[model samples]
Target chain A: MITTELFVKMTIDRWNGSIANVNKHLNALTDEQLQKEIAPGKNRGTYLLGHLIAVHDDMLKLLDMREKLYPELSEPFIQYADKVVEPTPTASDLRKMWEKQNGWLQEKFAKMKPEEWFEKHTAVSEEDFMKEPYRNKLNIIITRTSHLQYHSGQIVLLN
Target chain B: MITTELFVKMTIDRWNGSIANVNKHLNALTDEQLQKEIAPGKNRGTYLLGHLIAVHDDMLKLLDMREKLYPELSEPFIQYADKVVEPTPTASDLRKMWEKQNGWLQEKFAKMKPEEWFEKHTAVSEEDFMKEPYRNKLNIIITRTSHLQYHSGQIVLLN
Candidate 1:
């Protein structure tokens, strides 16, 4: 049988590995490339990167880790689509936010023990959690790993 | 603690969810759109779809489930990048193969018991798996789920 600790560790490994891949892809792109859309009339690399940061930032609230490192990111990246919110932070600033936010999250996530992951995230009500314990904090991490990879592929297409 | 059965079920749920999203995107795309590159000089939608099938087809061997559903896909989609091979299966044929193979694999995966998921897959040796038990059959599914989501994002960009 797989121990819960090992299972949680492997899941974390997948999350960290995907974050690394996105960083590699992002670093390889020029600022001008980040500005280009993946295709005609589609999202630019910068928009996708900003979107990833905003989603990951919300995980703080979703998992009850802390207040968002950059709540300002939510409006540009989440509530609006690529160009809908004219004048987002520069690609350079988004890169810094991505690094700082992910670094902070990595430290916080490492401190989370296996059993703690099985408990409900803050987004769920106590009553709802009692009925559906499967919607745990770790499930959010797993789903977000998939989300990060999805956007990583989109953003990397700019290269 | 969560039961082994529940954990495995949750993981499978994620795999199916991603598959459903991919299918949704594929169905919405016309064949003409599939021929276009995700970005200029990047992979076409048809190539990404075929690549996804080839990877998933290889999982039959990787998971020790069965023979690959389409050995032909390995050369064009896996061995070479898009357009390197003289011609690939029509987008229509690829869509059918994708449906047939994923349908078959889903059936096979649903039959696997939670304990079986922790066992080494065909690709791993007994000694290696003993030393690295985390490299289990279920781990392949998890990683492949991420891969599928990655390409799904790329393919969807054709829309």
Candidate 2:
């Protein structure tokens, strides 16, 4: 009984729900709170936010939707360790990046049709995609949703 | 593309991948490390493992696959907060429970056909399920995979 439309809707609902849950904790953070580590040695809340934004920005290309909005975020936030001796973005700067990237992602998702979700994205070849049909554009979104919520759970430790 | 078979395979792959990532970190943890909080004021690695065990136990019934292997885990691990007055399970006890539960779960998942995943399980009424086909049996697994990894991400902070 699971139609394509219903599948897409369910994915979107969970995606948004996970984001809302993370944002609730994120919005409550003070500048000082953001700088504190989620735990003693783990990455700081601010670093996680920037890392998430960088990853989501990469999703634009991975999902073959569009180019990244913030390619500049990759080095400090994604490539380097949080404890590395380098300058990092302020909590406010990362917050703006997160908001902007997700805002655009939301708009992009809204425009996608159910059928389009089944088509191959940038990652795999047309022939290869046919063999592993589930690795469609929609699957990327589903995987990323989990990735986002995984970090979100860590971020909630700041509460 | 994006047939039900591919969807089921993708879900199973991600579920297994998440478990492997968590287990890689888990296998390396000393007993003392399990007792340590992932971060100060956050749940200990022990609690997260037990909570994951309890939730996967619930998944048995939720997916209509089998009865729970450890019904007792529900109270101390799932229903109650970690700081409650109940006696907690040791790191070894929870580790055994996790292994046993997942071993059975992997076997159970291997037996499921693609069509079975699309059918509604025991939770929803037939009438309501018909209306909202998105609430299929497979959706539970999809959501839980994310739930497992979310906590797994938190637990990895101990490393």
RMSD of 1: 1.2
lDDT: worst 10-residue window of model 2 chain B: B1-10
Question: What DockQ would candidate 2 receive versus the native complex?
Answer: 0.67
Write model 1 residue lDDT over A14-94, tens digit each, in one string.
999999998899889988899888878888888998999999989989998889888998998999888989889998888
lDDT of 1 at A50: 90
Please state the Cα-based DockQ of model 1 relative to the true two-chain complex: 0.72
Candidate 1 lDDT for residue B25: 94
Per-residue lDDT of A124 in model 2: 89
TM-score of chain B of 2: 0.96
Instruction: After superposing candidate 2 on the true structure, give the runs of residues whose Cα lies further than 4 Å from its correct spot.
Output: none
Cα lDDT tens digits for candidate 1, B1-159: 577776777678889999999999999999888888887889888899899999988988988888888899899999999999968888898889988988898888878988898888888999998888889888888899899999988888788
- Write one digit per residue (lDDT tens) for candidate 2, span B1-159: 556777778778888988988899999899799888888777889989989999988888989988989999899888888878367889999888889888898998999998898888788899998787878888888788779878988888888
